[model samples]
Target: ERLHSYETKRANLQAIERLKDHLISVQLTDPSSKHRIRRAVSEIGKRLSSIRNLLRDRKLELDCAVNAAENFQDDLKKLQKFCEQTEKAIQLVESATIFVPSGTDLDYVRLHEPEADEVANRLEKQWKDVFSLGEAVIDEQFGIVSFDTILEILAV
Candidate 1:
């Protein structure tokens, strides 16, 4: 189960990386490429949502295990590390910029893509979903079931 969680995260990170590359490539090209890039970005946003949900579920499982254990110090540390990594991953996507044409007297360009606005909104929603799960894990740690229960459920 832990291995599955790691694989899920790896796949998500790869997807994000691919999206970043596509965005960068589009930025380097002409304005006509915006539509294609926008589509790619939208697809990436959907992938991000799926990945976040997977991670959130795994996080809950980890939280349950931690709560059931006698010592929470190490588990707490791991949780902190995971939180930091997650934040970094989100920041990576948030920091990505795309160029757009500026309509003004002065010769200037917009830094972020207008097409990405909707994608960003979707990404924000996914982030909020994952954050809610994180909050629930923290608040309901003791109430979560133990590994034995999970194993039994899996067995059936």
Candidate 2:
């Protein structure tokens, strides 16, 4: 199950990268052919939207699994800590930028005051949606682990 989750994530990441490359190609095309570029961009955007939805659904499943695991752990404190850390990791994955930031701390600024900055707001909004999906995927996987452990103990 964990391996499945990892593969899903890797595939999504690759799709996103390809979309970025497509966008760049559209941008660099001749101005006389701008209309064609616009059409291509529109199609790419739709595909990306679909991918985002798929990622979100996977993330929700992951979240459900994580929550179930918490109930079975013997040490509540340790379980809680693990849950928190897992959530953080998921959030980090969600917030990952398609384009690496240069010298500017774009991510930090975007997180702190996205509303005031137009560029930051756009970037933040896009990443937030993606990240939310990733978080769900992580949670569901954790839940799977919890369920498997319970089954193992019961079998004995």
Candidate 3:
């Protein structure tokens, strides 16, 4: 609605310009009448120019705001997906380790220790990557989810 109003005002300004042009083309015999018309045209032209500039500046500001919002949302989604993947990986490690007791079977432990170690290494790498992503989000001022909240989730 606001945009429509701006456009309407702009159209009116253009019409005013055409009228001013036609007025200027008219041959006026009185010096005072000519001077008055010229002064009015100059004032109206300055005001129209000012209005156009204001609209342009406002449009640029709106565009920048929209782009910033989109970038922030994209960053947020990326961070959220990374966190979910990391959580699933952590759950997998937990579930894998839970079934192995202290003295259940030496053979089973021996068979799975290498695999467990590999999982552990991968989990560590995942943590490092998640940390880096968190830092990047924070540095970019998009840290809507606090590190403490993330830490609490990880602790669970």
Candidate 4:
């Protein structure tokens, strides 16, 4: 059961990474939006941190539930709320158009984006609706190859 939950969470993170790529790659159409785009990437980092915290907290709470001899109702409710919050946050940042900042490193994006094509395609197949027009970021070292991301998009 936990494996399934982790799988869902992984997908959500993948989608978010793809969105980050799109924001970096496309925002270059306007040179003035670079700062705003940079800030948006920073905001994406915050969202990613929140998602991970929610997952970790849920797992800890589940452990408490398992150890309890009785009255696990509250733990279960908290877990449910965590799940809802995770999905809500994912939906909030799933689209680049909604959050991409105006100022972006267009020159950097043009040079590195082609390398992301394959990974982006795989991510698209995995979560079509969530990843708009973006490439899958395949970084072997947990590094952001094209965009500014808090976490690396490990090629899955």
Candidate 5:
């Protein structure tokens, strides 16, 4: 909505610029008419200058706001992906199943030990990553991003 307004105003400003140029080039013979035209043109020039300055400032502000919003959204997407990957890791660890034959208990234990240790290491790494992401979010984006929204995504 704001963008649309800005575009419309910018177009109007351009049209006014063209009209001002046209006015400046107009030929007038009478002294009073020429003086009035000159005064009107001068006033229009001042007003247009002020409007241009205001619009430029507003455009810069809007651009900054848009960039901030995009960055926030990118952060949220990264957090969401991390949450999903963590959940998958947790589920995989939780659902791990081991089977051993009755007479081969010792052999099965020897074979499973390395895999179990690897799983443990991966789980530990994922936990640390999740913790780090949480801390970073709290420290950096606390005021800018919505706390409850972040929490909800984390909980998922």
Candidate 6:
């Protein structure tokens, strides 16, 4: 879940922050080395902040998708009820007024929407299992993937 990712990122960022603070506390022998360490800490903090933002975005996206699916089901149900009512009115009213001897022209096709909750849940579960697949192709950590690695996998 995205919550787990947020927690993991929080923990890692906290650990990094602790290391940065310790680095700042210890008197570095070289001024240049101290400056470099501070810069590294700043960069790591920025990256962690970005990850936090991305996690929030993903959570919002998933929530929206689920809500849309729920709304879709509700609308589908309303449509079914409306059609049923129309068909019933056609059967009762048309037989008396229009003087149809046999059946009416309306076709009440029975349609059932599959469990929207189950479909959404299944997609979320599958994505949870498959989330790591994209990470293999895009090593966002280093912004690089070796061609040799790709070639070896392709050979497989």
- lDDT of each residue in 1-156, candidate 3, tens digit only: 877987787787678768766766777646676667677877877887798789899999889868866754564454445455555555555667546433334444445545544544454454456457743334433432454554454443
lDDT of candidate 4 over 1-156, digit per residue (tens)? 876886786787677667766766884557556557667767866876797789899999878746651333343344334444444444444545666633333433444345444444443343333233355444534433332231133221
Candidate ordering by TM-score (highest first): 3, 6, 5, 4, 2, 1
- On a 0 to 1 TM-score scale, where does candidate 1 land against the true structure? 0.26
Candidate 5, which ten residues in sequence have the lowest lDDT sum?
99-108
Clashing pairs in 1: none
TM-score of each: 0.26, 0.29, 0.52, 0.30, 0.50, 0.50
Candidate 3 has an lDDT of: 0.60
List ranges where model 1 is wrong by over 4 Å.
1-32, 71-156
Candidate 1 on 81-132: residue-level lDDT in tens?
A: 4444444544555665774323331111122223233333443454346446
Preferred candidate (TM-score higher): 4 or 5: 5
Task: List clashing residue pairs in candidate 6.
Answer: none
Candidate 2 per-residue lDDT over residues 19-133, each given as its tens digit: 6557657766666566565666567667766876787899998798576555333333433343444445445556778843352343443343323233333434543454468
TM-score of 6: 0.50
**Number of backbone collisions per candidate, in order?**
0, 12, 0, 10, 0, 0
Q: State which candidate has the highest lDDT.
A: 3
Candidate 3: pairs in clash:
none
lDDT of each: 0.52, 0.53, 0.60, 0.51, 0.59, 0.58
Q: Candidate 2's error at 6, in angstroms? A: 17
> What would the per-residue lDDT of candidate 6 be over residues 18-110, giving only the tens digit for each residue?
887787778854677778878988898888788778978988988986886686566545544544554564656556765653433233222
List per-candidate RMSD values in Å: 29.5, 24.1, 10.2, 32.5, 10.8, 16.0
Top model number, TM-score: 3
lDDT by residue (tens digit), candidate 5, 1-156: 866875786687667667755665676446666667667766766886797789789899879868865755665565555565555555555565783223343444455445544544454454345447754344445533555565565554
